[model samples]
Target: MYLYYSFIRVFKYLCRERERRGQTMYLRSAARGFLAFLLLVSALHGYHDWTVTYTSSTVCALRGSTVEVSCSYEYPDKLQNRSTPVETLWFTKEDHSQPGGLVSDTDYAGRVERSCEEHSCSLSSCSGNCTLRIRDLRQSDSAEYKVRFITNQPGGEYTGDPGVKLTVTDLKVKVPHWIRLWKYLECQSMCVLSDHPNYVWYKNGQHAEREITKMFYIKEGDSVSCAVEGSERFHSPLVCAKGIKNLCNKVTYSTRTMCVLQGTSVDISCTYSTYRGLKLKEKYWYAWSNNNEPTDLQKDSEYKGRVQYPVKERGGSTLKITDLRDTDSAEYRFKYKSKSHEWKSALHGTTLTVTGLRVEGAAVAPVTEGQRVTLSCSTRCLLPGQTSYIWYHNKGPVAEPESTMNKLVLDPVGLQHAGSYSCSVRGYPHQSPEETLTVSCIMCILCRD
Candidate 1:
């Protein structure tokens, strides 16, 4: 490849020289070109000792997606009984003169990945194939890529003369015509580099599914589009044909309300659906209070290390919250995304109410008639304004007006108040566990006896 490029450069220079002068200048330029070609051929012959062959000399990838450059290398074997260690690297620069040739540009710091598998390894030497995968590609990432390997043996470092060329392009939804007879709309990428990328399909601005093909049933008045799976972050613009509006599928939640004991964990569950061909790209939990915009709980400092969302089937997901607190009580919702959709929350959200359970008074108390007794039920934090307190006696509601308050008062203790007592906030599914209350009868002796 380098020889071809060099030849082009030399030919261009010779043509320019010919256009400038007569046969004398033309002859001189032709000689120089011949010398350059000879030098290139000599260099190529020497580099044949350690040759590398790439799967493809050029790759065209979509921006914001991933691309893999693969290559296999061949090298001469070292002396028998001597072991040599081998290291492989992929880079865009040819700076093997320095100790470090794999020094990547800052733009690709964490996005570049390399993997190697040794096809043959013996006491004398080793040979293998290497693949370089780059994620989140950008337009600026288009460049020439090379593979090089170093060995402990003397003069064992070799870099391929010509590298693979990458061309990064943005995705566009091309809709030439709808197949009315087939009842499907053919949506295609302007250009796709990967052979078998998962396609993210969208309709009217909402996600549909991870489509197996770039074709969909046309909905009258609905806009449709498609994008590469990982490139959903940089989705293609929506393309509509007949109608501008139509139904779009979305995610859904299981329950709208939940109550949990403080210090315990709770699972907030939901089931979601999207277009049949679209794939889920990401999912997370977010919360909002008092009409505020929802905030991602994963990024929230308070929820750090205490929150987890377990992976479920394509249609199901769950968020588990540990060490619940009163402050953690809020309207929580599940959010998910496919390649073409941004963060989307469920239409119905789940509300969480974390409460502490405690009985203020003793469970067993011996009291005589005419003695005042009091039993209180309270939570760690004041309940919401609409929350109501309900007192219970022996598993039944206490028929007292003041039972709504935190304290339940028996102005004059009697046997009727001797049964088990407990309290719970109205609207809460559970009440405090029952506590026993014992009452003693008062007796008087007659002096005449």
Candidate 2:
């Protein structure tokens, strides 16, 4: 403050001397310009001490989360002081209009502490400076905040501004029990508690802007998280936000780990406590085929892997499998009684299978009318082993002379033979879709169908 005031004073003296000496016009103009610059810098800082009536802001947080409220000021250089003259008192305004007392005086002044701050705001650049940090958050502490500035100048001590409205909001989360998000599946989920349109999701503490699966879908490896509207991501337990009602509200997320089972392989893992560190257990694999059936302990017809445990030294019976087959899939059951008499029953069931598409070139096309003809066709069982085929036309099966195998034969060909022909092969997964041969002038016969 003194430096700028001194510069202004010197500039005014120079201007007066120039006028008195009838100095060059340039000299007088330079003095005036310097004085104006100094004054502008000082006046800009004064704006910071005004009422916070320009904009109303809101902040959203969680039950046990923290948030920072920012305040900036612009004022004249002459008004700044190096020492903390006027105390910066930030308090919750339960109801500024209430003739009664506030409700949140519960050790708030002590629990709240500033985590980030800045006062470098020059009279000119400090327009966006002041801020306060509050931590160890609680839901009951939610309310509006009011800030006031006091200054003790050489002339007198005074106060500036009042009721800088800052609305506090809360966050609510419902992550029921176990949640299993799928792997390798395009999946995303979020916990939203912001009024802003900007939505964000996080997994393992990283920004996931493209994820749309917000509490929408679940499969295996993935977990769920969220953010307040203005938040970049919910990297923290609570999501802080602005521009919202119930503004400080926030929720956290968690997910259940997956139990992966494949046709030829069963890979299981559990998080618990063990002595020698969790390892494999020599146990029989038992499972049912569908949801309707009760859990069966009768050993499966064919099993691939043993019961595996995750996070060594934990007690859990999870199954893992490799080199699987279609029939190897079913509802698996396991039982574990800890060393103590405490026995708990937990069941995790999932049916696993791989989707496959196959195409087997049929026998050759029937003979063409105008050319010496040759006919060829073939039948195949797309699934692993069931090999059986049958030919069908507009009606049902065009069975052979009471034969066993499926076959296709072309008679003396002609223009009329150039019609629709189809073949059917059966077994495994689901039924195979019918493939057709649309014989165009298909001597030029390259049918896409």
Task: Estimate TM-scores for all models.
Answer: 0.40, 0.29
CA lDDT, candidate 1, residue 370: 72
Q: Candidate 2's residue-wise lDDT over 1-449, tens digit each?
A: 78777876787787788889888786757867776886787687554444333133556554434566666543333445454343345555434633211222434522455422434445422232445666545556666665544444343222223433333443332344334442222221222344434445554224454433244343222233454445332233432221123122121213112222122344544333222222334322346333443322333334413333332333334555555545554444443333432112122323344323222332245444444332222311112222354444433455452222323554544465444444444522222344443333544655643
For model 1, the local distance difference test gives 0.68
- The superposed Cα distance between candidate 2 and the true structure at residue 164, in angstroms, equals 5.4
Candidate 1 lDDT over residue span 76-122, tens digit each: 66544566567887777544564233434555644567888865755
RMSD of each: 26.6, 27.3
Cα-based lDDT for every prediction: 0.68, 0.40
For candidate 1, what is the TM-score? 0.40
